[model samples]
Target chain A: MIHINEQQVSLSGEHSIAELAEKFKPDSDIFIVNGYPADRLTTVSDGDRCVFIKKGETPAPEEFQAMLTARHTPGIQEKIRKARVAVLGLGGLGSAVAAALAKIGIGKMLLSDYDVVEPSNLNRQQYFTDQIGMLKTRALRENLLRMNPFLTLELIEEELTENSLPSFFHDVDVLVECFDSSQMKAATLRSVLTRMTKVSYIGSSGMAGYASNNSIVTKMLQPGIYMVGDDISEARPGQGLMAPRVGIAAHHQANQVLRLIVGEEERRRDEHTA
Target chain B: MNILLNGQEKECTDGSTVLELLASLKLTPESVVVEHNHEILQPEAYTAAELAENDQVEIIRFVGGG
Candidate 1:
């Protein structure tokens, strides 16, 4: 018996993936077994989960392997693949963080940004020259989809307001704060933390200039609030935001989100004892 | 009396409120979130909430840039 897309199929003997595809999805030319893309010549055994892919489809082999490698134990990859995250910005930090999360196989992401990509943003933001005139929400969604077509992105092309925050936070498990101004960041955090008390918040602060990479760190500000960055650096007239530092902080936020999704701390403790 | 503020022991006048603590620290009440003894204090309660000896306090402010 072989499991095809979680459904078991009784087989008389060992068969190639192509043979099974011919029997099951005869119209398809591609097959995936247990997450990796398998050619028809690859053999399928008992209990194998086989899936058919349409022609011209981009098989997310890298993403599949990433999910498998991310697992500390069985089913942990599914946990990461199912978790939903909301990112409230699409600038230097938000864009990179979203990309990293997509690569890590996050199931869904809700992106909120009202600005358009500017020529100045090319210095440090995750956008190309062609995307300069496009709305950040649209550009970011397009970019993320290109990287991982399986990632579900809910794009909100409006500034976050008191009434809108609740709606955006409705189903997401984690809220990522990536606003560029302090006032907006403060307001967003206050509104979300006070209203949506259960959602985890990961924010970036003080990622500016060419500061020492070690200065960028994650701080547990409160029970569900985690801040990443140096906590002191700021973009000034002379010293502006750079790509490297912003990317560092963005990854810090992304890494923390991954940890929260997979329960990395608890898993670490479990591993130490065993 | 001595109280732990963001994990550091700080001496404060007895019967001081959270507002007074913020004043001493020179932090704007609207710009920071305060937690007293692990319980987050609503912004409106800052003026009336008093700090006791040995009470732990955490004050966090938003920083700019993504």
Candidate 2:
């Protein structure tokens, strides 16, 4: 048995990826075996994972979705697919969070950023130096789309004030606060948790400098409110926001979003069990 | 009045608003998120959100970073 684009199939004899692609998908030119680009001689054994895609062709949206969903937990595909996630501020945490969620095949995303990519942002943000001066909303969307063409995105490029925040995300299910400013971060969280009654809020703090990653943990401050960070470190002279720590916080927010979305599925299943 | 603040048994001035509680703890207004009885208070709502005995108040203070 071998996995092709996350679907399992039985093979009669040993076959290299090139042989398998030639046999199964003659038109497909890009072959990925176990997450790496399969060399001309890479062989598929039992339980090996392979993905074959055409160089310039986009698969049907449903096929793309199936390829993504086949690897998740049995019941998570539907729940996570329906979740609407909004990422505020495309900085270190926000950019990384958006990328992580998109990489995991999140169905819909509302990304808001009022700034443009800058050379300084290259230190920890998801943007590249080539993207410098491009609007963050536009650059991030382009990057995310390259990875998953089926992702639905709503990009807002304006600065989000408290008055403008609530109106932008009426139907959002999970709002992740990735603002670099403390005031803006708290403002977004407070606005969403108070005005947007139905949205779950996940906010981050203290992803600056080299600290024990162990201190960074997610806390459920209330039923629907969450905070992920060490909660103490502020950016200073020597201790600046680095990629490693910011990436951790970003993924923490992303994982918490997945947990919150998947937890809803668990809750519904539990309700039926009683 | 006595209330459960961050899961700890804490005492505050009688009839203290959420803002006053935060002030008592020396927390700046812009740095923390305040939730009263499971409902998060908006920035302006804090000063008017008076706490009662046995009320649950959760305040999460955050620092600047990405």
Candidate 3:
């Protein structure tokens, strides 16, 4: 028996993906096995999972949505679609975090950044050359929408402060701290931890310079607070923040956000109890 | 009195406030966050918060890029 798009079928002999597509979906000329595209001649065995794509056809919006759901757990895509995440600061870390969360089908996102995109930001930030003069929040919104049109995004083009952070955190489920300055990060954490104790926060620190990737790590700072990156390295006049390391730290933050929304911690606790 | 500053032993003036310690280290109050004995010191409290001997202080500053 082989699974095709979550459905199982009994097979008598070895069959090529093409033959299976023809038998199961006569109109589809392309086949995908376990998320990877396969040629028609690719052979499949028992227990193989397959999905058929129509010939010469790009996935429609609905098809793309289906693909996302097929890749994740049964109800995770829907949970992500209903959750609201706020990314503060549209710099290297923030841009990557926002893009990652959006691609995973997060229902709503609040993007905040006061600065416009500069050419220097292209090194690590997720923005285009055409958006050089546009606000970072606006550019990020456009980029995310292009990937997931159904995403709901709220753009804030102002600097965040202690007084203003609460309003943004009002309805947000997760708050991502992506500020460039250490003082700002501390201020934001202080405000969020003190004022909005219920909201989850994922932050990055010490993600600078071309250091060993192993140095980057994610730690649960406290309940509802997760921090990623090394705690020692800092960007200085000579040493600068590079794309690879920044992307690593940003993805760590993004992953933590997803885990929180999916109740991964709770699942682990349940597993331990059992 | 001597205290641990970022893991290094440093001699601080007796009864020195966090702001004074930052000034002695040539670090601006706006650029660094101070944690006194594992508790993060708020910016407003830096001036009045006093330091005791053997206090474990951590000074953290942000990198401007990214």
Best by lDDT: 2
Provide i-RMS per model in Å.
5.3, 4.1, 5.4
**Candidate 1: TM-score?**
0.74
Q: Cα RMSD to native, each candidate?
A: 5.9, 4.9, 5.3
TM-score of chain A of 1: 0.76
How high is the lDDT of residue B11 in model 3? 97
Rank by lDDT (best first): 2, 3, 1
CAPRI verdict (incorrect, acceptable, medium, high) for model 3: acceptable
DockQ, ranked from best to worst: 2, 1, 3
lDDT of 3 by residue, A1-274 (tens): 9877556798866899878877877788667787788888998889777888786665566656667877885599878878889898989999999999988889888888999999988989999999999999888988988877777888998888866898877568888989888767777776665567567888777888888999989877456677788876777777777789999999998998898888884211211110
* Candidate 2 structure lDDT: 0.83
The local distance difference test score of each candidate is 0.78, 0.83, 0.80
Separate DockQ for every predicted complex: 0.39, 0.58, 0.33
Q: How well is each residue in A177-273 modelled by candidate 1, as lDDT tens digits? A: 8888876776666666656766788877798999699999998755566888887787778778888999999999898888888776321111111
lDDT of 3 at A194: 52
Listed per prediction, chain B TM-scores read: 0.92, 0.93, 0.90
Candidate 2 lDDT at A40 equals 57
In model 1 chain B, where is the ten-residue run with the lowest total lDDT?
B26-35
